[model samples]
Target: MNKKVMSIAAMVAGFGPSAYSLADSQHDEAIERGQAHYLLFCANCHGVDADGNGPLVELLKVTPTNLTTLRSSGSEATVAERVLQAVDGRHAVGESAERKMPVFSDNLEISTVIEIAAYLDSIQK
Candidate 1:
């Protein structure tokens, strides 16, 4: 192919939509819900900014995980898995040991938990 044709093809390839892009609208809506849920139920311990420095941190025997660093090493899928497990009470961590974090399975819908996981994953360091 000519250089110009090759360049055009490259541009088109880059612009092609993937499955994730097709779900962007849904993901955006989910993120909004997750943000609201986090603020209302998780902020007191996870912190409003998700930095694990909430006012109640000092009272707890175990420190909350610094959520901002949640994805420092793991893939997004791994992070999502961990978040789901934690919410479902299947994956307790240091903070969970103190029983400070409640099992959200009864409170949050599965979709909401997944949404929260997506939002948290989006903000990873």
Candidate 2:
């Protein structure tokens, strides 16, 4: 290869890790925001750790689902779909039948919902 071409390739290769690190940093920031939003809006029912044993769950007609298990629902598509429905208030996938989880469409922006979904996915084992 030409010397100039080889140098350009080396420079481009060196930039890869920095670009990936920046993207990772942004993902971390999104997760942090999602965690804050979950704490403020969902922790009361879902619990601070998302185990679904929050104090308020006892008073409710139904219990909330342990969100950490959402990945076991079979696939990422299913999880994403359920999250969208819950956020949209059309249905509650894993929660108890009588639960009255409020729709967040009006209270949160669409980007917030996406971030929450991403955060939830991150925590799923």
Candidate 3:
């Protein structure tokens, strides 16, 4: 087929919508994966709603930061970096020198941590 005809066919095939659908699919996948990680690793402290009111809160010396307001409450970049480090078994963003949160660096992949962060950021209140 001629180049012009091929281009026209591509456009007529809902290529534009297909591309958009793919992007939406990817976003949805990311959110799902992220939510899984959050539920497994974070919900215990951050709560299912990321509200810092997890069931385990009464047992802890320090309160968990509300994950949903990480950006509105403070710097988004700072929050993201802190989350990345916390998940990687490094510094705890808001923890004391005697950190209490479980480190998942060995258990979770970097990509998974990133997905969780993206999900958390997207749900910011």
Tens-digit per-residue lDDT, 1-125, candidate 1: 23532443343233223435766676667778878887887778889889998888988877777777876755343556666666666554555354456688788776676667667766768
lDDT of each: 0.65, 0.66, 0.67
The window of 10 residues in a row where model 2 has the poorest summed lDDT is 8-17
Q: Report backbone clashes per prediction.
A: 0, 0, 0
In model 1, residue pairs whose N, Cα or C atoms come closer than 3 Å (at least 3 residues apart or on different chains), thus clashing, are none
Candidate 1 worst ten-residue window by lDDT: 8-17
Query: How would you encode candidate 3's per-residue C-alpha lDDT over 56-119 as one tens digit per residue?
Result: 8998887887888776764534444556666655553444456666788778776687678667
Cα RMSD of predicted structure 1: 11.9
lDDT of 2: 0.66
Model 2 CA RMSD to the hidden true structure, in angstroms: 12.1
Give the poorly placed runs of model 3, Cα more than 4 Å off: 1-22, 76-79, 92-98
| Cα RMSD to the true fold for all candidates | 11.9, 12.1, 12.0
Q: What is the TM-score of each candidate against the true structure?
A: 0.72, 0.72, 0.70
Candidate 1 whole-model C-alpha lDDT, 0 to 1: 0.65
What TM-score number comes out for model 2?
A: 0.72
